[model samples]
Target: MHIVVVGLSHHTAPVEVRERLAFAPTAMEKPLHQMLALPAIAEALIVSTCNRVELYAASKEPDTAVATLRRFLADYHGVPLEEIEQNLYDYQGEEAIRHLFRVSSSLDSMIIGEPQILGQIKTAYGYAVEFRTAGLILNRFLHKAFSVAKRVRTETGIASSAVSVSFAAVELARKIFDRLDDKGVMIIGAGEMCELAARHFVSNGVTRVLVTNRTFERAEKLAAEFQGRAVPFEQFTDHLASVDIVLTSTGAPTFILGHRQMEEILRRRKNRPMFLIDIAVPRDVDPKVNNLDNVYLYDVDDLQGVVQANLKERQKEAHRAEAIVNEEIGQFHVWLANLEVKPTIVALRRRFEEITAQEVAKTFGNHKDLTDAQRKGIEAMANAIVNKLLHRPIALLKRTQNETGGEDYVDTVRELFDLPAPAVDETPLEPLDDDTDNR
Candidate 1:
């Protein structure tokens, strides 16, 4: 059987197209079973996330399977095939293996090194298992993919640093405060960035959160989500001294907090250090506030600069990850090649042994006068001859299994020996000891 993947990712399709094609996890069983019902599909798994939708399958006829999957995706989603056909890509055999490893390792993500894709793949594999769509090849393939991802994470620093602006701001906060357990965070707006940064702070051990927005109700709604207190927009400065970290993203054209107001707030706190982030387009905090003693101020551009630098660092680490993926692909290819040739090897050996036994028995029948010891010696000689004659061909089959025309080589040998091709087994394999956790 051949491994194949057919799908569209963020690189090939827009969110609107992806969302339409995506399969809900709760509803996966039906589609997975449907995919397995197709003529060429033996095992199937679907991975659907915000950025991509893909189907991974094991098939005897991969080219036919790819075409069938494209039609299945369009028909299943009630979409016109022409609408999505151009976006669909298919990879078979080794290329399919490479694509899966890269995806599991997060190298194929829009933001390389992001960890969510790995978990998403794991969840998708779980659905395949629960629905009985993953057979031996897919089960082993996914487990191998997971191990490759883990190795990439451990050997390289791809996910070691913050690359998003909101997370980068939190990283900056950690550098200034050293420990956030005793620190309080104050968000000056109800914007998405402010909410995300606040979440990052809270997750990083910030104990208190204060929220204030021009719309008091919005502030209260956001504060309730974080279990924080909502302060009135007009009286926000009154609560400033109590907060060590402040994230501001309001719509005010002029600076909301000026140099003089921060000086007073500093004095109220006995000149304690403060971290101020101004992510607003119009500049919420005064640029001059950065000059104040014990105050670390950053604007949108500053945070973006940090994000860009970290992204560059991540790109460097991604090169290392790519190398790891390449190395893993070779290893997986060897295993897959062995799997493909195993049946042929068994049949070849069985054919030779059968011929050896038949010729030896015929000789014994022709010489009935021979002693029992002589017959045993003749049988032993025949067995040794069969082993010696079959050794070279078997070794050749194993060694050439991963090369081009490997399947043709196996077929030719089977035909030359008049050995019938073995039937493909569809049974699921027992779980390996190492893959027991579904990690």
Candidate 2:
């Protein structure tokens, strides 16, 4: 089965289109199972993040799998198939593998080199593994992707600057406060982005955290996880004055924290500096709050600007990382191509050995007076002769099979030697032991 990737990302589609296709964490299981159930799909994994919704699958017919996935996405999202098709991008075979590697490494992220994508990929992979939808190919591919991501992060400067909006908020906070250990951080909503920002703060030594949500129970749960205090939605304004860093990410259709409310909090805080980050789509914090003195209010757009600047710097390092990926891709291709001729090489060797053994046995039957050790030595010599005669041709075939457009050469060798085609097995091969060295 060949690997195929079908999806749209921030680079190819706007947020509106991406959001329409997004799979909520709780809602992912059904669609993932459905995709895996497709006849053409041998294995599947779904990576659904805020900016991208991609399906990576091992399938016999990649085009058919792509159509099936596209239909499934359109039907699940209640979007017109035509509309979804226009924004979708498809990659197959080597390109698909490269795309997955790039995405896991954060090279394809909306904010390049942001570390969140790697976690998201791991989460998706874990889900697929739990659901038993990802088989050997996907498992190996994702594991390699994870390793490549770690390598890129360590070897490149792509992750040096914070790029995501949530992390950017933390970066800005560090710039304002000499130390975050004494700061009080208030998360206005129990959303994913808000949770990420809260985690960033907790990791960076923020002392006190206050989680307020529309639903008090959800707020309490989120707060408990972080060992923070939970406050009701009504008390958000009351707690604002105590917070040094306020991050708001609510799905409210209207503004939850307006200028008037923030101005009152500013007065109560005695003109102390405040950092407000609004990461919501509709913007929970009012845009007018930026006009307040000593108030450093940033919205999604502003955070995106910071991310954009970091992306530019990351692009420079990305070129270097891309060179490494390209080299690895070529190596992987060579390995894959050589795999196609391995069976033929094995069969050819077996054929020569069988002929040698048959002749040795017949010759030995007439020489009954010969000692057992002498017979064994003669058999070994015959085996060695067969190996020596076949060695050059076998090595030449393997080398030529690794070249570009080498499949034709492989097929020619197979046809000339009357070698049977190799069977495809998902199971890994066992390592050779010392006893098997004679072969």
Candidate 3:
């Protein structure tokens, strides 16, 4: 048996192509069932995220399976194979296992070390379990993949830092304040980055949100979205004392917030520390405002620097994560190798036992004068001889299954002994944990 994966990702395909191949979580059962129906595929799972779409399968004929998966993708989405063939990539054996490990560990993400892809993969696995598409190999493979991801997360700093500007602002805010639930945030403008930062702050437990824009209607709209109140543009300074965090992003060419304004605001708040994020390109907050006591100001450059530094840290941690993946791949490959050899070993032993039984029966029938003791002696001697004769070959098979040309040895053994083909394994798919996200 062989494991294979065929699909396209952000590295090989643009967003338009990815979108075309994407699968909806609610509708996975049909395609999974269809793929399982194909002769070339024995087990299957589909992982569809915004950045990637992949079909992972276990098969006896790997080359045929890869072609089947690629065609399945094109046919399912009603796209011609030629249009998407260039964007597809396929891997088999250890390479396929390596790809899955890297993806589950977030090392293959467009933004390395992001955590969402892992959860998305878990959800896909959940669908496979629910639909009974993933059998023995995939059940174990996916669980192992999850454990490898967990190890990477625990042993490395890949997910320890924020890699985006908006998230960096929130990270700095988190460091300054012990808790964000009680802190109030104010947005001075309606720039996209400012809105994104505001959303990040709210998701991270900021309870209060104050939005101010040149247009009162825009402020009111944004404030309502956050479940907070809107402050008029001209009167936003008056409300600064009520907020602990401030994010400013406006198209104005000059500084809208100066040192004098922050000094008075600090006094009104009894000199409490405040986090000011100035993400506007031309600088909305005056550079001199950073000199005020108990006030922390991070302009665009400052936040960008923080993001760059954090990205580098994540990159360093990613190398460690790759090592973890490689170690796991080796272990999983051994398990797969054993899986491939198990049936052959069983069949070889059975073949020897059957031949011995037939010969022993013929001898007893022909003699017709054997005593019970004599028959027992003959049976024991026959079993011992069979075992002795088979030991070396079975030993060789087990010892060599994990090495190069292992499958060839299995084939040669089967041919020499004239053993029947190994039976297809249809073990029931095991259910994934309900809390896959936590792991």
Candidate 4:
């Protein structure tokens, strides 16, 4: 089976289309299992994030896999197939490998060099593993991709810069407060983004954290994980005045914190410096809060500037990372090309050994005086001659087939020798704990 990736991302589709196609974390399991159930698909993984919804699968026929995935996506999103078809991009074989490597390396992200994509990819891979959907091909490809990403992060300077929105929020807060360790951080919601922001703060040694959510249990649960205190939803505004940093990310479908409430909090603080990071999609903090004295309110768009600056710095290191990926892609292509020749090589070797065995038996029958050691020597010599004769031609054929599209040469080899079709074992592949798989 060959690797095929069919999907739309920020590069091909806008956020509106992407959101429509997005598979929520809870919703992914059923669709993933359904995709795996398709006869053509041998393995599959779905990477669904805010900006992209992609399906990476190994299938016997790429065309059939793409068609099935398109239909599945349309049905899941309740949108017409044609609508998504227009924006979808298909990458097969080597191109698919390169695409996955680039994604894991963060080069394909909206904000280049952002570290979150790696985590997202790992999460997707983990889900596929849990669902028992990923097979040997996908497991190998993804593990290699992860290794490439880790190398890029360590060997290059790409990760040194803060490029992700969450880290950018922390950077903006640092600009306002000068020190994060002494800051009091009040997280306004219990969403994933907010949780990430809180974790960033906690990692940076923030002194105090107060989490508040519409659901008190969720707030308490999240807060307790980080050794922070949870406050009642009604007390969010009151506690807002005491904190040096306020981060809000909620799904209220409306503005939860208005200008008037923020104005009162700002007044209570008595012109103390405060950093307000509003990461919510619908905008939790009022836009007018930026006008208030001693209050620095940064929204999603503001974070984009920081990410942009970080991207510019990372662009220099990206060339190095791209070179690594290209080298890896070349190596993978060589392996793939060899994969197409493996069955022919095996069959030809088997054929030669069979012929050698038959001829040896006939000769031995006539030479009854021959010793056992002599007979064994003759058999070994025959097998060695067969291997030495076939090695050069097999290597040349593989090279010619991969380079010149010489299907006729491979076909001739198969037809003349009566070789069997290539067989791919469908056993589930294990994940690598170290770099042993790479070797």
State which candidate has the highest lDDT.
3
The 10-residue segment with the lowest total lDDT in model 4: 430-439
Predicted candidate 1 versus true structure: per-residue lDDT over 315-367, tens digit per residue: 99999999999998888887777776888889888988888888988998899
Q: TM-score rank, highest first?
A: 3, 1, 4, 2
Q: Please give the clash total of every predicted structure, in order.
A: 0, 0, 0, 0
Any runs in candidate 4 off by more than 4 Å, and if so which?
A: 27-30, 37-39, 75-78, 163-203, 206-307, 340-343, 359-391, 397-416, 421-439
lDDT values, one for every candidate: 0.89, 0.82, 0.90, 0.83
| Candidate 4: clashing residue pairs, number | 0
lDDT (tens digit, per residue) of candidate 4 on 3-116: 889889999999889999898897678988998998689898999999788999998688888888888888878999988788898888778999999998988987677778
TM-scores of the candidates in the order shown = 0.85, 0.59, 0.85, 0.62
For all predictions, the C-alpha RMSD in Å is: 3.9, 9.9, 3.4, 8.9
Q: Model 4 reaches what TM-score against the true structure?
A: 0.62
lDDT (tens digit, per residue) of candidate 2 on 1-439: 4689999998899999999999888867788898898879989899999989999998768789888888887888899989878899999878987898899788998667777888888889879988899986687677777777777878999788776778887888888888999999998887788898889899889979999989999999998988999998997889889989988888899998888888899899998999988888888887888899989889888988987887788999998778767766676666556556676788788778778989999989888899989999999899889889988888887778767556666667777777766664565633311211100
- The segments of candidate 3 whose C-alpha lies over 4 angstroms from its true place after superposition are 20-30, 71-83, 190-192, 208-242, 250-253, 263-272, 292-294, 421-431, 434-439
lDDT minimum window of 10 residues, candidate 3: 430-439
State model 2's lDDT.
Answer: 0.82
| Residue lDDT tens for model 3, 156-242 | 999889988998999999889999999999999898898998999998999999999999999999999999898889999999999
Candidate 4, residue 189: lDDT: 80
